[model samples]
Target: MPIQHINPPGLLQFDAMSQVVVASGGRTVYIAGQSASDVNFEVVGGNDYYAQSVQALRNLRTAVEAAGGSVENIVSSTVYLKNLTPEIAGRFLEALAIACEGKSFPPHAFSLIGVASLAGADLLVEITAVAVIDAAVAA
Candidate 1:
């Protein structure tokens, strides 16, 4: 990946992202926001937020990986949940941490929001992420 880690003499690079992610020599891929849908596009986990969250992440991972990037390469993520509360957010974080075990430089920019409803009645959560895969790697 041409995504180089930047450092300023007195700055904390670990907590901050590169000022500008130069993707010149790499292929940029954009994945539409993904919902918790199965192979048949049938939304999963009707009323179960946690289950739906799990499924959403799984779906997001699959899409990103298919595009030549892994979840670990994800630089940003946005999660939309229905009726999200502090407790529910914590649960989602926990699940995310578990799923990212052993993956370095896990998602840096993360956003979570609660929405009134999703596209389908059975959908409870949706996740979208951006990853940079070096063009050389993809080639």
Candidate 2:
């Protein structure tokens, strides 16, 4: 599949959503809200935002790849947190940075949201994304 990126002049030249158009066409994989849970479906991080965010991202990655996708296939991701604070946001970014280490992941549309809770009480973060895989390419 062919992908195109567009960045207008009006908005700030930021990474996420600093542009308008993302991809042209492909097979879309819609990942559900992935929480900080392991194969057993138990929350990995208790109340820690950083730990939870990291685990959530990891979960998201696994789901995407299992569905015949990859990190580079992700076109957009939404991060849902228990609270949206500067410190928390920083921690989340840190977690993301660590998780993306030694990977071919690229920046995509990102949005952060503050929610009262998630699937479980102890969970603190949930990540969901849209991945586009070319039909000719296998996974």
Give the candidate number with the greatest lDDT.
Answer: 2
lDDT of each: 0.66, 0.75
- Report the C-alpha lDDT of model 1 over 29-132, residue by residue, as the tens digit: 67788887898988776677666776777788788889988764565677887778998887676556545342323534667899888777777788777777
Q: Clash pairs of candidate 1?
A: none
The RMSD (Cα, Å) of candidate 2 is 3.3
Steric clash pairs (candidate 2):
none
Deviation in Å, model 1, residue 49 alpha carbon: 1.9
Task: In angstroms, give how far residue 19 of model 2 lies from its true place.
Answer: 4.2
Task: List runs of model 1 lying over 4 Å from the truth.
Answer: 1-24, 100-105, 135-139
| TM agreement with the true structure for every prediction | 0.73, 0.83
Worst 10 residues of 2 by lDDT: 15-24
Residue 54 lDDT (model 1) = 68
